[model samples]
Target: MGEFFETYRPQLIYALIVVLSVLLLRFLTNLLYKWLLKQELKKYPNEKPKAVNWVKRILNALWLVLGVIALSSLIVNEDKYDILKHNFKLILYLGILSIVTIVGAASANLWFRVSINRKIQNAEDPTSFKFLRYIAVFGIYITGILFALLAFPSLEGIAKTALGGAGVIALIAGVASQEALSNLVGGVFIISFKPFIIGDIIKVTDTMVGTVVDITLRHTVIRNFENKMIVIPNAIINKEKLVNYNLGELKICERIEIGVAYDSNIDLAKKIMQEEAQKHPLILDNRSPTDILNGNPVVRVSVTSLNDSSVTIRAWAWARNYSEAFDMRCELLEAIKKRFDNEGIEIPFPYRTVVLKKEKETHKNHDAGQTAE
Candidate 1:
């Protein structure tokens, strides 16, 4: 046993040192990770500490890799140790690059969340901010990859070769991804010129009416009335004519048209419509100061058209938003109909007169016989 210990003493000592070093490294990394998580929580109480979690995972992975390397070094011969020592700088560079990439990406995402919160507080548009977050994250990853390639002497040569043919490679890639590129460009345009932001109610096609839920790099997501998500390609959406209800002014004017019997008192019907609209809770008083001073009616009712059986009257009712306007219109319709019935103002239906052909022929024959007599 003494002889065995003497022969393997160097290996045992090296192994113990490696183990102690790994334990120390783990303890220090845990301390750092905990501090970072606590700070993140303090700064953003509502948000999850995703960046700190990512850093923790990265540190764990790094420690595992370093532990493996250190243990393996104990068994390797002198020549192999020299090789490991020679390439240690390359390994360190790659590890540092990985850490920087993850940290940078996490920082970009954090910045994006902060900007979005500020925009919401200020009531500013956040469409551009949302789209730019993806761009920023992607750029960080690409930059990290480039740095990694430059770190290795062999990969540095390859990078130069690739850069030399970048033009041709880019042309081929562009041709292959034409539609994707178009969507990207469309996304950029949409961000630059604010057409509709998230939460805005918009009509893309005659059949598609929904609220903008999310705008991504390639597509826009809309949640329709049925609560189904509709994904439209940015390229197509940019080309189509859009109707945005929540654009400049969120107020909407709802036109309620009701037909009344021609014999019914038109003035009474118009007054009832105006009264019902004014009584609705969602109705907005959008009249200017000048109009208010002039005593303009809260709801404007007008004779739109005179039909064969009825007179069509239209009431312009204003509401603060599309949802309120829709609700107000429906309630007004029901209320006005009841009021019309109570006030003896009739809503007319179509009337058509019909005669029997046989009766007409019989009458004509009787008239002819009487003429002959």
Candidate 2:
């Protein structure tokens, strides 16, 4: 055992040195990464510093390369060491390329998010900016991959072969990624057409009512009234019929429908509804200059239908946005109901009349028996 230890002392020493060097580099890299991340968080409290993660990843790769190089230099023969050294340089080049690409992507993404947040705060449209950000990030990743393939000597032949078979590869990829490509195209169409921007309240289906929160290349995110996020693929959402509450006009005309007893005064009911809607804070005066001049009412209340048990009165209440409109309508409903109760106007339930045919037949048979007796 003593002879073995003596003979292999140089190899053991080399291994220990390589391990320590890698550990030291990793420790330093982690410390630097954590410090940078802390500073970044201080600068942007809401944002996660993704670039630090990229830095850490690249530095780890660098330590790995250094360890391999140290090991080769100390333990391997001269010929093998030279070959390993050449490979080390390639690895170093690739590592640097990766770091640049990943860091640039992360930095650009962060910048875009920050810019979009500012736009949102300023009440500006961020739909185009968000779309462009996704496109730019995707393009950067693709370009990096292509450059890496072209720059590496060993991958050059493979890249050339792939290019030569571009047509076949495209055909195969098109078939395999048809849905993904459709979603991408759908996302482009949505951004270009501007059906619904972020912050717009849209009803995609009867049950899928929400505000558009985010639109990405693959999907759109909606935050519903319940505060739950619903992720729908771009293609599916684009194909579905949706009602955009903020498309052309931000103001919404909410129909506040109420039913009162048939005996209730129709004019009084209409006046109560109009007055209740007009007094709400969120209610908007959507009357135009001509309308005001023509003496049009701010809140228009009309008798829509006279049902069997009650009269259905509807008031058109305008609000600046969907959220305000919803809140306004709810408050108006409660207020109007209380006002109607105080004014001696009753909201009637659906009255139903039922006749029993068996009871009528029994009475007729008893009358026939009495007449016979």
Candidate 3:
């Protein structure tokens, strides 16, 4: 053992130097990163120091790369480690690329998150933020991977070969996955235009009224009134005409119809309907421009139609949302019914009058016979 130690003392010394150098580099990197981070945090208390963090990580990665290169340089003078001298540079390059790729990808993701947090503050649609983050991370990592692959001469040839056939492969893939491609495009448009956000009440059709629960690259999930989820393709959603109840303002105009006897006082009935609407808890106090243009009251009442036996009274009222509007309409109707009963305003039922035509004909014939006699 002593002879072996004596023979390999120089090699052991070289190994020890490399190990110590790497450890020292790591320690310095960590210390520098923390100091920079602390300074950045102190300087911008309100703003996120994510960029600083990313930079620190990148610097640490570069330090490791530098240490590897230094080690390679130190070991090159030793003839016993010929393989390390020749191939270590390639290995170090690949290692550095991998580290840089990972750190850059993570940094990009963190940057995106901070951007989203700042720009989309209090945004109801986190799905858009999440999708955008995924796309950004994917792009960054893919770019990094491509760069890493080019570090090797063999992979460079493979990459060139793949690129040569890329056009044909892309065309075939496009044709094969046309629907998926359309959906992906639609998702992009939806996020950009923001036709509807998560938690919005939407009506795709008469039977498909629901709240938007989730929006993905390919599909949107709607939770219907019956608590069942309806998964709709993004392409279909883009093409179809849909109603977003919560798009502009949360308030909605609700119409409550009531029928009263023709003989009842129409003006009094209108007043009662308006009163009932105003008294409802769910009704909104705010009036719109249309309301002002029409000289609209807090609750509007009009004679919508006259039926065979009754006159239809339509009352328009506003509520904060669809649910509130529905409840307001129901409660207003009940309250109006009670008010009508108290005020002696009758709500008429459907009835038909019939005359005995045969009896009248018999009587007429008898009268004619007596006159002839």
Candidate 4:
């Protein structure tokens, strides 16, 4: 045990120092973070938590860096230890690599998170924010990894060779990641064109109808009415059909179709349809009577079709948004159904009147008599 202690005295002491230093650092950092938060709170009264979180992230990254540096200083002194004399370069390089890796990863995560928060706070469309942030973080860490590799003299030649083949490597990567590149480009186009922003109700496909929750370089995320998230690739979205309900205006035209018996009062049905639609709270009533006469109103009822079974009464109503329009349509349909039932107006179903043939009946009667005899 004595021999073991003697042999590992420097390492054991270094380990103890690192542990103590980390504990002290954390304590100091917490105090500093709180102090900074207090200062930020004074400047940003409404956003104290956000400001504090940002400060805390920065401090956490700094703390990691300081810990690594302090640990390296304790071990790298030539006069203090002969254990690292022969392998000093290798140990130092490894230490530097570890420090860089930790700092790079932590800072990238913190900074990108801050960026995303800022975008959200500014009411910016964040469809591409996550993807762009990830790309930035990946690039930063890849660069850090390359820089760390340079710390080893043995890997310097390999690094130089890689740099020399940069063009060929890029071409290979371009070919291999063709779909990814297309998606990246598609994301940029989507952001630029502003086809649909975050929170817009979009119909990617008949089944994929939902509110756009996010836009990323690779895909667009949608939160459906069922509360399920649907992720569609940006490349595919660009190629496929997309309907943006939030485009142009916040008001939407809702159409409700109802089938009434042909014998029922058509004029009364139209009036009932119009009244039912106008009663809904979601229906927009900004347009004047003049607008209604000019074929634009909160509610309008017309006979759209005359089928063999029934007359189709179409009710058109305006609503504040897509969701409101849907609700208004549903309410109007229910109200119309109840009013029709109460007023004794029949909703028609398909039917055919049967007429018996006299000659066929006589032949059947004669055949029955012959069988009986």
Highest TM-score against the true fold, candidate: 2
- Could you estimate the TM-score for every candidate? 0.74, 0.75, 0.56, 0.65
lDDT of 2 by residue, 1-373 (tens): 9999899998888799889989998999999999988889998998877778888988898988778787877767887977788778767777787888888788789889899999999999999999989988986776567667866778777656555656435633655588998898899999999999998889999889998999999999999999999999999999999999888888888999999998889899899899888888898999999999999999999999988888999999999988888888888889999999999989999767887999989999999999999
Which tens-of-lDDT digit does each residue in 287-359 have in candidate 1? 9999999999999999999888889999999999888987888899999999999999999898788989999
What overall lDDT goes with each candidate model? Answer: 0.86, 0.87, 0.77, 0.75
- Pairs in steric clash, model 3: none
Clashes found in each candidate (C-alpha, N, C closer than 3 A): 0, 0, 0, 1
lDDT of 4 at 48: 30
Give the C-alpha miss distance for residue 255 in model 3, angstroms.
Answer: 2.7
> Candidate 3 — which residues are off by over 4 angstroms?
36-91, 120-134, 152-180, 192-194, 197-233, 246-251, 257-272, 279-314, 319-327, 330-373
Say which candidate scores most in lDDT. Answer: 2
Query: What C-alpha lDDT does candidate 3 achieve relative to the native structure?
Result: 0.77
Off by over 4 Å in 4: 1-95, 122-124, 127-129, 145-175, 286-297, 350-373
Candidate 4 per-residue C-alpha lDDT over 1-373 given as tens digits, one digit per residue, 9 for 90 to 100:
9999999899788878777877786788789778867865685564435434554555556556555655666557767555444345544555455555555655555666667778889988665566666666655655655566666679766555544557435643655688987787787788878798887899888899999888876788899999999998889898887889988888888888999998899989888888878777787876877987897756778899989999998987888888988877878888999999998888998898776799779989999999999
Supply the global lDDT for candidate 2: 0.87
Count: clashes, candidate 4: 1
- Model 4, residue 361: what's the lDDT? 94
Query: Which lDDT tens digits does candidate 3 get at residues 25-50?
Result: 77887887789678757855665666
Q: Model 4, residue 155: what's the lDDT?
A: 72
